[model samples]
Target: MPIVEINFDGLIGPSHNYAGLSFGNLAAMKNAGAVSQPRAAALQGIAKMRSNIALGLTQGMFLPHPRPNRAWLTQLSTDVDSASSELLANAMSASPMWAANAATVSPAPDTADGRCHLTVANLRTMPHRSHEWPNTLAQLRLAFGNEQHFAVHGPVPPAFGDEGAANHMRLTPSHEAPGLEVFVYGVAGGAFPARQHVEAFRAIARVHRLNPERTLFAAQSEEAIAAGAFHNDVVAVANGPVLFAHEQAFADKAALLDTCTRLVPGFEYVEVPAAEVPLTDAISSYLFNGQLVTLPGGEMALIVPSEARETASVWAWLQRHLAGNGAIRRVEVVDVRQSMANGGGPACLRLRVACDPATVDPRFLVDDAKLDRMAEVVASHWPEEIAVADLGRSSLIEAVESARAQMLDLLDLTQLASG
Candidate 1:
C-alpha cells in the first residue's frame, strides 16, 4: 500500500467567535469580546485547503461540530437562555475548528496490526473542549471506517487529559515506512494547564498496539507551557525525517534529540535558538504552529501564518535558514489571522493521518470543485459577523444551526448533523 499524509482540516464553524475560553492561550484572551467574521474565517480556511491541494497534497475535511450544543447544555440542566455566562460560552464555543486536537494517529507501518489507528482526544482539561470527543469520534469513524485498513478507538478515560496530535510527532524515511512516534506530554507546575498528560499517551500506545521500542515520550518544556505554548505543535513540528522546533520546546532537549537520532535513521533537526526568537515571540507569532510539509518534488516547505512574516525575528530566521540550505527549503506564508486570534494556525487547523487515501471515505476528501461549492455555501449561509455578546441570541443560534446544516447538505454529509 502506498501511504501518504493527508491533512484533514476542520471547517471553521458558522459560530466562530472570540469568547476567550482557552485559559493559557494569550491570543484568545487578548482578543476576547471582539466581533468575529464567520463568513470570512470559513472562506480563509477553505482557501488554505485549496492552497494545499494546489501544492499536490491530499486534503481532507471534518465538518464543524454542532454548536450551541444543546445536548451538553441539557446535561447541565439548563438551556442557552438559562445557563451561566461561562456555561453558555462553553456551549457556543467554536474551538473545535482546531482539528489538530481531534486525535492521535499511528500509521499502519508503526502499528502491530499493520492497520492505521486513531484515538479520539478526550480534551478533558478545558470544559469548552471536553465535550468534543463524541462528535469527533463520529467523524473519525465515518472517515476511517475501513476495518481492513484502519481502526478507530474511543478516547481514553477523562482522568488523563489528552490534547491529541498537536502534542505528537512522527519521524520516518517515508510515510509508508515504520516510523518512530514521539509523544510529547507536559507536567502541571506551570501557571497554565499542561493539557497533554503522560498517562494519556501511554494508554493510547497500548490501545494502538504500537511497538514499545518504536515509541518514545518526551516532556514539553514547562517554560513553553507558561508562555502560552499550550500544545507542543505551538513550538515544534516534525515532517518526514526533519524536526523543526524552538530551542526551549522540550524540557530535556539533548536527551530527546539523542534518542531520536538513535531510533530514527537520517533524523535531522532545525532548532531555533531562544536567543534569536524569544519564546514569547514564538508563541505570539505561532512560528512553529505552521505545517511542515513535504512537497511533491521531495523538498520540504514550512506553511506558516502571515503573522510569522510580519514578526521580524521569525521572518529573519526563516530567510537565514532557507539561505543556509536547511531541511526546510521554502516558507509558504498564508493568511489565517481569524484562526490566529483564536490561538490556532495552519498546523492547528489540521490533523495529519498517514494512510492510503483510497481506503478513506471519499466524502471527507476534497477537490477544487468540492472546495468551490463549500465556499459558496459558506458565503450564502454563514453569518457575516458574530459579536461575543450575541452568542445567546435565538437568531444567532438558529443562523449557526442553519449554516452548518447547509454545509452538511452540500457535502452530502447530512448524517453528521446529529453527531
Candidate 2:
C-alpha cells in the first residue's frame, strides 16, 4: 500500500498546524520592516542551527542571541522589561507608524466620525503576548462598530509536555479554517519552551499533543496558518499529495505517512523518492500558497535548504490553481524567488488568529458579542501604515460581502432548520 497523507479543514486560523494567538490578525501587529535587513557589520556565522529564514524573523531577539555577543541586549539594559520594550520599540521605530497608533481604541486612521468603532459603548479583552503586540482587544471592538467577533489562540501546555507556561499556542480551528494549516506535534518535555493557553482552548488541546519521545510526538509541536477560515470545508480540503521538508524521520518515514493518513485519509502523500539524497541545510524547502518560497541565508546553508530556489512542481500546482479562480484572468507563473537560508517554511513564518467557521452552530448565531469582539482584534493589529482609513475601508468591504454570502447560505440552511 502506497503511503499518503490527508489535508483537512476545521483547524483554526492561517492553516499551519500550531500557534499562540487568541484573537484577530496578530501578524499585522509586528513591524513588517523590522527584519528587512540585518545590522551585522560583517555577515559571518549569522546562522547556526537554522537557516537565514529563522534568523531574519527577528527571532534573534527572542532566540537569546544573534551574535557571539549573546548577552548584548541584557548588557545594554538593566531589566528584561526594558529589553522587551526596547526590542518592540526598535521594531516599531523601523516602521513610521508604531507609536502613532499606540492605542487600540484610537479611531481607524483618518476617520473622524465618533469613535470609529462598533462597540464604542464598551469593548472587550484581547490575548496578550511578549511578542510584538498591538492595541488591546477593547480597542478592536471600537473599530468594527461592535459588529464582528475576534478571537486568538491562547498559549497551552505543549503536547510533548513542557514544564509550564506554554510559550506558544497552536491556533488550529476547532471548527474550520478559511485557508491553509500547518501541523507539528512533539513530546510533553523538550528543549523548546512550554505551552501557554489562555482561558480559552483548555479542553481540546491535550489530545492534540501526544508523547514527545517518539516520531508521533515529533508530529506534536506548533502550527501556523495564513488567511481566514472559509465557511466551507469542502473548499479547504487539499487535492494533492503531501510534501515534506526532508525525510526528517528517516526510516520511520513510512510510519509518518501512515500517521498523516490516519489523521486525514482523504488526502494522499507523494514523496520525492530518496536515493541516498544528500541533505541540505535548509529547514524546509516545500511549496506554499502556490509559490516556491525559501530562506537561503542561514548559519549553515549547506545543511538546510535556506536558498530561495524555485521548485518547478510548486509552480505547476500554483498555475493550475490560480488560473482556475481569483481575479487574475491570465496566469503568469513568474518565478518570484528569493533566498534566506532561513529556519523554516512560510508555515513557520506566520501565526494564527481568528478562525470562525460558517457553520449552523447555534453558538455562532446566539453570541451577541461575536462581531463586536472581532472588531477589537482589528483595532489591535492596525499599525500606522495600514491606517484605520484604509483598514476600515477594506474590512467593511469584506464584512458586507461576508454577510451577503452568509445570508444566502442561511436561506439554504433554513430548510434544514425547518426540517
Candidate 3:
C-alpha cells in the first residue's frame, strides 16, 4: 500500500465575517467587527489549493457547511425565519471555513485494521462551533463512505473537548510505513481555557486502535496556551519525518525530541529557538502554522502566510533556515488574510489525509479543470463582503443559500444542496 499525504482544504463559505466569536484566539479578537471579503476569501482559498496542485501535490476540496444554520437556530427555540438573540448569533458563525479542525484522520498505515480512519471533531470549546459536528459528519460520510478502505467515525462525547488535527500529529519514516501518532493536550493556562482535553485524545486513540507502543502523548506548554497558541498546530507541525516547531511548543520539548529520535532513527526536529523568535511573535505571525510539505522533487517546502513574511523575526528565521543544508529547501507565501483575520492560516485551512488518491471520491479531488469551475461559481455568486451588522439582513441569508446551492450544483453534488 503506497500512501501519499493529500491536503484537503475547505472552500471558504459565503458568510465569513469577523465577529470575534472565538474566546481565546488573539487574531479573531483583534479583528472582530471588521468587514470581511467573502468572495476574495473563497477565491484566495481556492488559489492556495491550486498552487499546491500545481506543485504536483495531491489536493482535495471539501464544501463548506451551510450557514445561517437553520437546524442550529431551531435547536435554540427559534426558527431561521424569525431567529433572534443567541439563536441568530450562532447562525452567523463562519467557523466551518477552518477545515483542519474538521476531523482527525489516521491513515491506513497507522491504523490496526489497515483502513484509513477519520473522526470528526466535536469542537466543544467554542459555542459558535459546537453545532457543526452533525453537518460535518454528513459531509465526511459522503466523501469517505468507501467502506473497504475508509472508516469515518462520529465525534467523541463533548464531556471532553476535541479540536481534531489541531491537537494531533503523525510522524512516519515514510507515508507508506507504519508510523507514530502524537496527541497533544493542555491543562489550564492564563485566562484562556485549554481546548484539547487529554481524556479526549486518549479516547480517540483507543477508538482508532492505534498501537499503544507507537502512540505518544505530549503536553502543550501553558506558556504557549496563554500566549494565544490555542492549538498545538499553532506552535508545531509534523510531516513525514520532520517536526517544525517553536521551542516552547511542548511541556517537555527535549524529552519529546529524544523520544521521537529513539522511536524513529533519522527523525528531524526543526525547533525555532525562543531566544530568536519570541512566543508572542510566533503566535502573531503564525510562524509554526505554515504548511510543511514535500514537493514533487522530494525536496521539502514551507507554504506560509504573507503575515509571516511581513514579521521581521519570522522572515529572518526562514531565510537562515532555508539557506542552510536542511530538509526544508523552499518557502512559498500565500495570501489568506481573510482567514488569517479569523485566526486561521495555511495549516488551519486544511485536513491532511494520507492514502492512495485513487481510493478517494473523485468528486472531492482537485485539478485545474475543477479549480476553474469552482472559481466560476465563487466569482458569480459569493458575496463581495459581509459585516457583523449584516447578519440580520434577509438579503445576506438569501445570498449565502443561493451561493451554496450554485456551488453544489456546479460540482454535480446536488444531493448535498439544501432543500
**Model 3: residues with Cα > 4 Å off, grouped in runs:** none
Best by TM-score: 1
Q: What are the runs in model 1 whose C-alpha is more than 4 Å off?
A: none
Tens-place lDDT digits, model 2, residues 173-269: 1212111122232222232321322221222222223222211222322222112100001011122223333333232446645654554423344
* Model 3 backbone overlap count: 0
* lDDT of candidate 2 at residue 379, scale 0 to 100: 32
RMSD of each: 0.7, 18.6, 1.1
Q: lDDT ranking from best to worst?
A: 1, 3, 2
C-alpha lDDT values of all predictions:
0.94, 0.23, 0.89
Which has the higher TM-score value, candidate number 1 or candidate number 3?
1
> In what order do the candidates fall by TM-score, top score first?
1, 3, 2
Q: For candidate 2, what is the TM-score?
A: 0.31
**Largest lDDT belongs to which candidate?**
1
2 against 3, candidate with superior TM-score:
3
Worst 10 contiguous positions by lDDT, candidate 3: 80-89
Per-residue error (Å), model 1, residue 201: 0.3
TM-score for candidate 3, please give it: 0.98
